[model samples]
Target: MWVRYLGFVILFGLPGALHAQPCGAPGLDGGYFVPLQETYSHEIEIIYACDSGRKPAVEGWWATSTCQNGVWSPEPQCIGEEDCLPPEIPNAKFNKKQNSWYNEGNTIRVTCDNGYELKNRDATAVCLNGTWTSVPVCEISNNTCGEPPQIPHAVIIGQKYQASFAADSKVRYKCEDGYSVEGAESKKSIFCISGSWSELPKCSRGTRQNTGHGSSVEVTTSAGSGTQTVGGGSGSSAGGTAGGHPTSTESGTQPGGGGRGSGDVVHGGPTITGSSTTSVSNDRNSKPAFIPVNECGVSPVIPNGVVVQTERMYLKYECNSYYTRVGPDTVVCTNDGRWSELPSCKEAFCVLDLAQYSGIGIRQTGKEYIKEGETKNVYCSYYDYVIFTCTQGRVTYTRCCEAYYHNYGGC
Candidate 1:
């Protein structure tokens, strides 16, 4: 008996086996553990499974809990179908295989409505940890345009009927009589490039006539008001010349001598005199404002890819794992305020197809998927075997055979 005690001590160590406490039932709800026992020793692991049509609240159908310090670590429990409901997405719906409630590890595919596309091409969501993965978003395609804006005092040249327009469609605007486009010599036009329209043109009063005396005098009248503006130097009054800047004083006097307003002016500078005040604005030192051109919007989005902005107008594209990038990776904002041709990502692996080869034996009947640079083994017979490798969706294989296998020409 003493020798037997020594063997027990050697196997389980000294004080831990004798002093360590055991754990009682884990008290799992909607599930049960295997190999039931009244108490479990420390560090003993038990497999857990849920009832029919149920799965562990965790990621997988089955789970394992360990007994530690007189308690179960995870305290396993099962989740019902109500835990996860079908994901709802705008402008999109799940395919026919969609279930009312998805179990853990189940996947669902979706299709977008007309004129809309999935944010991530061919993306699917999987149920995990009692929740669903990120669902694909539906967005309007970049090639369509909404209704064009209306221009004030101008009408569309053609029929004003359609609610929406296709990409690259141009709409011409004709100003009403007595008003022409502010700076456009030809007809005003705005094009619907991509998904937005170009800047709209403005219309204003046109053609002002000047008539005065031989002392370089000019007279003009306001549109609706009877106020008259007279400017010219009469041999030496320090008045503004017809085409030159004012040097001493400028005034705007109401016709028929109703009221007069006077203001000081800078030498060799343009001046503006209003009818109410006696002050004038000097614009000799003001610099011209600059406007930037070709401002692009947010960068284009790609499925299974990421973008890194290298500059204000340039970005670099990179594909996720198991995908191959096609076309240029770097794109720059063009002069038309649009991004260059965007790149695409293609799956870099091939699905296993044994239909082309004869006498090939596979464990499964349907197709098998694999990433690039991975290999799959095929059995042709007792003495024949073939190893296949996938690269960029193409599959190639090599055969190994003995003397008997070579003579039999495989299965």
Candidate 2:
């Protein structure tokens, strides 16, 4: 029987043990005996099955025992799936005073006022978790002014206005004499940021004095004065009339005086007596004396002619002669008449005979030789006829008479 029980325990596990409970059997000694009764707790331990063996028991595990009372029991099993928690949501807040935001993964944008700008972040921001990785802050941005107005007689202080300037911008003021600053005397420099000037310059009446000479003229203005002196022989003068009359002297004896006179008389006043003082005067009071100034002293004008002498011929005047100056030392004439140093005649020469024919008396063919005022012609020794002319003043000829008579000359 014991062997059968042991086999059952191995085949059917602990479940079979419940069926085998309450069995009475006798020992070899013949004494009465009962089957040993045992008790078990209802608790069990479970481990995770992984590639690296197993993890510590997290679920489906009992703390103390696996079985309880007379029943068979098992520990609860853990649901074996991926059990990771989702990421935590971030908390975000806006800082109204700072005009920015705090946190990561959260966004905040910035804008500026009309005349101002954002000194810091100009875009959105993000918040991540409990802790903000990036915090954005907005600051004041712009601080500038417009161009200052232009001032006459005053110079600009410096360059253009800077929104962030400390000092060093300055302007200076000045004016002519008798002029002063109306408001502030020492306040030549003005602060640019305030946009105010130092003061307006002012002008007052001034006095002036003429230094020298005849009519004294004065010009006065609110700012200053000017003076001018007129008349006198050797000084500066003023224009226009003085009192009611003209400023120039009325006496003709003065250097630039006007008077009525004729034939070189200094009139309207006294005259300086020189070696020759013929006090000439003019009857017409309206006209002044006329004194001509002499430019040419003692020069003579020569006539034009051609004068001929025994040894020289002076071809003086070819009518309407013209001379052109070329340079300092050269003069050119239109005609061919020119003289080097002296006027002299040139010797005239001419050939005595022109024809080669040999004859004594006039060989008259059908031609005849007339006297001075007549036309003439002669026959050549070899040809027909030719004409000859005599000298203007006189004419004479001598030849071999026999040769001439034999050679066609009728003796």
Candidate 3:
């Protein structure tokens, strides 16, 4: 009976009948295992024990299967948790020394240097995960200066001038001779970059030299004034004296060589000059002293027999009236010595001659009806067959045209 019991025990203890020990099974002594589940698709944490007597943790997911005690179990997969975290993007710039992180959204900003404007958008950026999208580079904007003011005939020199500029740009200025600049000279040389001109410079009145001897002199030669002194003397000699000094000398007479007689007399002329005279015997006749010509005041006098008159709206001159038309009208000189031109006369109108019936007479030369100085032409016909037209006032030829007296009874 004891032998029979031993055999039954041996049969139950066979390799297939007893529980099989796990080869690399993870458990409480080495590491903790997270059971596989559909919801847990990512890496699961596994706490494992190392030979150093410290418990270490390994992360992995279920990879293979195993059988133990007639039951099948899922294998725990081991991998690094580093991969679970998102990858670190390189070359990402962070401001304020802030560290980049995953799962947390952050942003970054960019700027440019002075004198260099940003070419890209000035204000936005983003942080995705631990990385940032490549942002466009900030470039320098174009530099420019605006055009200068419109000073006609002015020239600008440098290429630095362009349309986009601020105020206070400098520009130069210059003007032609007869004209002068008004504003600040230095400022004129430079203009505001914005194109405005500097203050204008002051201009002075022009001057001219007069026609006589004094150093500085001015004369007003208008129509009324007969003579203006403009520096030189007129009758007596007034200038630098014999002592090399300037002086004005009036009329005076010197002693005569023979006997002291009455002194020679000198009269004033238009121009001034020095005169030396000596007394002579009253018995001897003497020529008059030298007198200067009238240089300042002299106007030409109109001569007689010169025809100075208006004809056909023009000035006409005739020495004799024999070859020209003669009339009672004439030009004359006024008391002021100024001559007047002949006035235009009135025209003559045709009138029927009751006695001669066929011929027409001047009803009244419209001369009587015309205004004092008005002019007109006159037309007449003989026997209602021939036509003649004459200009009133001065002498003029009679003109004959085909239509001279058409409707006024045949000429």
lDDT of each: 0.59, 0.28, 0.31
TM per candidate:
0.29, 0.15, 0.17
- Over 109-166, each residue of candidate 3 has an lDDT whose tens digit, in order, gives 5554422333433332443332344443544333223455545444444435555332
Worst 10 residues of 1 by lDDT: 256-265
RMSD of each: 21.3, 56.4, 44.9
lDDT of 2 by residue, 1-411 (tens): 999999977877767445533311211121111222333222222222322222112232212113333332232222212221112222222333231223223344434332233333323333333233334344332222233444444433344543432211234444343332322131243322212222232322222233333322222111111112221221232343333211223211222123121112111213212222212222232431111111112111223313221111111222112221111111111112332122222222222243333353344434223333222344444433444433332333333233333223232
lDDT of 1 at 273: 46
Model 1 clashing residue pairs (backbone): none
Please list the residue runs of candidate 2 whose C-alpha ends up more than 4 Å from where it truly belongs after superposition. Answer: 1-145, 161-187, 193-411
Error of 1 at 9 (Å): 99
TM-score winner, 1 or 2:
1
Whichever of 1 and 2 has more lDDT, that candidate is 1
TM-score of candidate 1 versus the correct structure, residues matched by position: 0.29
Q: On a 0 to 100 scale, what is the lDDT of residue 277 in model 1?
A: 31
